[model samples]
Target: MKALIISDSHGWTHELKTIIDRHRNQVDVIFHCGDSELSENDEALKGVNVVRGNCDFGDDFPEELIESVGGVTFFVAHGHHYNVKMTYVPLSYRAEEHQANVTCFGHSHVATAFMENEVLYINPGSIRLPRQHPQGTYCICEYDEKEISVTFFNTHGENIPELTVAFKRK
Candidate 1:
């Protein structure tokens, strides 16, 4: 299965629509880590999975969520509540509690993807306002029963070669 992960859009509906149009049917799932700031009525996310961020005021979105896909469990959150900018301690603990194979979040506006102890952790950065990096970014995860591969993509929709990572299921 394949998944498109994005976060911290901060209300860039037009860009979000472009991204959805490009990957909607190609991936098995779409994850929005939050700060969408878009109304639920917007059709840009007809079938996307999303969580709320601190900036997504009054949106009725949950602070965290869990989902199972292709035999893998995913823990999704906005990261601020967990103090992501400081460290991953709290988030890692939460992932362990949730027994998640993958943990995804957004808050720092920086893209990161790595695996530790057979678990995948990803931050898709911001599509609207990136910090410390000029390029806006997102991530794609491809997995089956044996292995998984992750790739980060820039705003131009080009993959960042050096940011790719491959993992074997333990």
Candidate 2:
């Protein structure tokens, strides 16, 4: 299965729409890690699995989401509640509690992906205001029975090859 993960669009609905249109057919799921700053019912988020960020005031948005796809369990959160900017420990603990195979979050605006204790953690960065990288970015993750491959792409849809990674699934 394949998934597209993005976060921190901060109200750029047009961009979100473009991204959805671009990858809708290629991915089985699309997730927004939060801070979309748009209403939960916005057309731009029609088929997306979205969580609420610190900046999001929509009561309709959930604080976290748990989804199962292609036998993989994913825990999605905005990260601010877990203090992810300083450490992943809090988030890691939560993922353990949920028995999640992967955890997706965004808050620091810095893209990163890694595996810890068999759980994959991914932050797709901010498409509106990225940090520690030249271009704002998102991520595409593909997984099968053996491994998961992740590729980061800038807002313009260009892949950032240096950020691509693959890991063995537990």
Candidate 3:
């Protein structure tokens, strides 16, 4: 299965819509790591799995979300509450506690993808206001029962190969 992962859009629904439309059928799942700022009433995210960002104030959202697709579990969070800008400690521990195969998050506005202790950690960066990196970016993860492969792409749709990672289940 292929999953599209994005974060920190911060209400740029139009951009999000365009990207989604471009990859609709190629992606089996859409994961939003947060900063959507838009209400649940926004129909652009009809089938997305979203977590509440620090900026998402409504009671309708949750701080974290865990989803199981194609027999793999994904733990997603917006990162602020996990102190992601400073360290990955709490977030890594949380992933361990949940026994999640992959953890996706955003808040640092810097893209990253890596595997440690058999768990994948991914941050797709900010789509609206990129920092550190020259361009805004998102990620696409392809996985099956045996392995997972992740590829990051900048706003211009070019693959950011340095941010890619592939893992084989132990």
Candidate 4:
């Protein structure tokens, strides 16, 4: 299955819509890692699985989500609740509790994807307010029996090959 993972849009509904539209037919699921600043009922968020960030003021969005898809279990959160700014150890513990094979989060605005302790952790970065990279970014993940591949893309849908990574599935 293919999944589109984005985070820290902050408030750019148009950008999120454009990104989603670009991959709407290619992905099986879409996740927003929070700080969208959009109402839960907003049309842009219609089919997007989203979590609340420290900046979200509504109660509609959850703190995290646990979903099983294409044989991989995913734990998606905004990361603030798990102290992602400091370390992934806390998030790792939470993923373990949920028995997640993958963890997706945002807060650091640093895009990265890697596997550790049998769990894949992904940070799609901030699409609107990027920090580490010169351009805002997001991630797309493709999962199959042999391996899972992740690729980061800029806000304009340009692929960032330097950040692409793949891992063999166990």
Q: Which residue pairs show backbone clashes in model 4?
A: none
In angstroms, what RMSD does candidate 2 have relative to the true structure? 0.9
Ranking by lDDT: 2, 4, 1, 3
- For model 2, how does the per-residue alpha-carbon lDDT over 1-170 read when each residue is reduced to its tens digit? 89999999999999988988899999988999999999978999999999999999959789999999988899999999999999999999999999998899999999999999999999999999999998989999998988899999988899999988999766
User: Which segments of candidate 4 are over 4 A away from where they belong?
Assistant: none
Query: Which residue runs of candidate 3 sit more than 4 Å off their true CA positions?
Result: none
TM-score of 3: 0.93
Name the Cα RMSD for model 1.
1.2
Q: Model 4, range 1-170, lDDT digits (tens) per residue?
A: 88999999988888889998898888988999999999988877888999999988869899999988877789999999888999999999999999998899998989999999988899999999898789999999998888889999998899999989999987
Q: What is the lDDT for 27 in model 4?
A: 90
TM-scores, in order shown? Answer: 0.95, 0.97, 0.93, 0.97
> Model 3 RMSD to the real structure?
1.4
Model 1 off-target regions past 4 Å? none
Give RMSD to native, each candidate: 1.2, 0.9, 1.4, 0.8
The CA lDDT of each predicted structure is 0.87, 0.93, 0.87, 0.92
